[model samples]
Target: MHWQRILVGGTKGAGKAIADRFLRGGGTVIITARSAPEEETESHFVRADVSTSEGTTKVIPEMLDLFKGVDIIVHNVGGSSAPSGGFITVTDERWQQAINENLFPAVRLDRGLLPSTIERGSGVIIHVSSIQRTLPLYHSTLAYAAVKAALTNYSKALSNEVSPKEVRVVTVSPGFRETAAATRMFER
Candidate 1:
């Protein structure tokens, strides 16, 4: 499946790995993140804060320009900056941050890109979710888990809506991996 042009939100950790795989398979990979990846990859990095609408707005033109348009989208950006306390300690601000980081990027990107994909009548969307969505660790990742739950449900609904249009939407729920964020969480 050579998608030719692919867009991946969050070009770090698992996102980078996925982009690398696509690049190795001869696909053009464009990756977005607040900062560059730790190391160089075959992917073209688009530095944008995907946690905000402004950032996503910034990305759309660049992405469209990069490859004319994309055929595949991987929504992989997610994390929490809130203090790792129980539910009482998790503030409203933190909850919103989780939604911004984990959920809205996908929503906004789909809103922006899916039109072209639908017009082409062919594309794939992979929403990277968390196992925590079902098996939560409330001590630290409650907000992330809850937002991912919403994302997973939304992805499923999107699959239902878009599959009929010939755009395949899939959600990939991965278990814990030792990314830098996870290392930080463990250190905390």
Candidate 2:
């Protein structure tokens, strides 16, 4: 089925790649991020931090108004700012930040938008995760790994809950790619 309105949760990395393909397919795409995309895209841009409920609240009304309704949601926002240390060295704030960044955006967006999808009896929600979730690197990615693991499980559980409603939920756990961040990591 052709998706008329698509919402992409992040706009500067893998999310941008996804948005580009949708735009190329003649779909109306809206991409959100805390800042503007470094490169231009055909998709509509919304500036909001999806990691926080406050940010999602700011964008949801505007998005629904503009698109009228969203048929597909691609949640691709996630990252780790936690310092490189074992779990014992990680702070409470860092753990919360990990959840906020990697997991909560998808949770909040789905919470806000899934009802509409249910009412329509059709929709798709794709959560992009990382392999680190299962094969964790405890030194630098302890918190990120933990939250992504949560996100993976949440996606699966949400799929089970929503599938009967005719809403399709998918979680994609991809290995490392040569994104700017990964490239920088290699250079370092």
Candidate 3:
């Protein structure tokens, strides 16, 4: 039997890239998005917001049933909201949304799924964080930076908890990729 993996991301573009790469290497990949994809392959898509607990809870069970639990989890979901103006113009709701979007999904997914990874004692989990999390692009991204910082620290601490038991938890903090979001940010 082949090992299965899951890629959790809000937008499927980057996650789909990762999944296709993995699928080429022989592992089955399950994609989780707000709307499931119609593609027929090992790339199984499930619709779940994930930024909310309800969404994450609703999706994890279906995944467990499909693949008998994932051997790897790539937490590729993250993004920022708010206008081009500085911090002064931003509202509390956007700040809250940033935290919920960039951080909570990983937390919820790991909380619900890590137990199985621990039980198997052999899985690698990667969280796609952001360098703005540390560098702080300022203005609109300040809150995003702060939340991702919290997420990085949380991931590090969680690694300590699970690493000793054989699960590898690591985070990849990316700067601006030339994706649609970055292009728009540059244009603004």
Using lDDT, give the best candidate's number: 1
Better of 2 and 3 by lDDT: 2
Worst 10 residues of 2 by lDDT: 1-10
Error of 3 at 66 (Å): 2.5
Query: On residues 69-188, what C-alpha lDDT tens digit does candidate 2 reach at each position?
Result: 688888888887666657887899989998999999888888887887788789888898899999997978788898999999999999999999999999999999878766654442
- All candidates in order of TM-score, best leading: 1, 2, 3
TM-score of each: 0.93, 0.92, 0.91
lDDT of 3 at 112: 85
Q: Which stretches of model 3 miss by more than 4 angstroms? A: 38-41
Q: Write the per-residue lDDT of candidate 1 for residues 37-155, one digit (tens) a residue.
A: 77768777888887899999988888776666688898888887767787988888989999999999999989988888898879989999989899988998889899999999999
Q: What local lDDT score does residue 163 receive in model 3, on the 0 to 100 scale?
A: 93
Candidate 1 lowest-lDDT run of ten: 1-10
Q: Which residue pairs collide, candidate 2?
A: none
Candidate 3, position 98, lDDT: 88
Indicate the TM-score of model 2.
0.92
